[model samples]
Target: MDENEKDRILKVEIDVSGKLHLTPEKKKFTLIYRTATEVHWNTEINTLYSPKPRDWTYLEWFKHIIKVTKEECYCELNITEQTEWVNIPNELKKEITKAQQWL
Candidate 1:
């Protein structure tokens, strides 16, 4: 599996009836959020326009469960948090630029 596709942000989906839906076989998990935005505002609210609403989406990806073992103990995890970051090394950046014909 592609390492990039192995990771994705997770969120819980709860119905109006106050029940959670989860399935490990389908890589579906749940996360409870305390608060969220109900609307959005533009850079300048000079015009008479209602604020843009907020839309939350869950990313679909296969989850990989790995077990970490040390001489002292073992740790098990079923859920993983996808971090938002990509730091390319200086040499890699140069290669990417050349490949894209920007250099």
Candidate 2:
């Protein structure tokens, strides 16, 4: 990514309500916000930044959950009653893999 893109990503804001506000370049959508939630770490990272689950970090897990929540928010039909928690979709695993590259 270019410097401009990196800067944009760095500027992402979390409002008082704990929502990530991202505005992608050249995207028609003006405001793309995702709710931010706490992610628990199974194992703490050592001084070298290594953990038992090397591939999955707290930020990665947060991104995965946020993406799923965004999709649910955009769903047309509400098949089930809305709840405080969400069910992470299996397909999101693929997306999480792709996100790891950029993140």
Candidate 3:
């Protein structure tokens, strides 16, 4: 995927129902939650492709699976009141900042 697509994905948010909410357009996408092991096995079987193979971290895998499934969005399971900000990737951070300006 290109930088634009990646940024789009990064701008998404998860709603209370565990659904992914896309930005600007406010489109909702369903997610098929998968374990890291499942993703790994799928990759091994050629059922999935890492967008960034060199940096095939769990987050990348999550993004890749979401893109491939063509789902609306992803919500990290087990979110709580104490949920904290994840370490946003530099590229994604830029997108978030840009997105905030429109709010």
Q: Against the true structure, what is each candidate's TM-score?
A: 0.18, 0.25, 0.24
For candidate 3, the TM-score is: 0.24
- Writing each residue's lDDT as its tens digit, candidate 2 over 62-87 gives 46434433343331111112212223
Candidate 1: list runs displaced more than 4 Å: 1-11, 25-77, 83-103
Clashing pairs in 1: none
Better of 1 and 2 by lDDT: 2
Candidate scoring better on TM-score of 1 and 3: 3
Full ranking by TM-score: 2, 3, 1
Tens digit per residue, CA lDDT, model 1, 1-103: 2221222223222234422222222222121111121111112321111122133221111111121111111222123333211232455334333432311
Give the better candidate number (2 or 3) by TM-score. Answer: 2
**Which 10 residues in a row give candidate 1 its minimum summed lDDT?**
61-70
RMSD, one per candidate, in order? 17.9, 16.3, 12.3
**How do the residues 8-85 of candidate 3 rate in per-residue lDDT, one tens digit apiece?**
332334334333332322222322235432232122222232333344543444454444344323322221223233
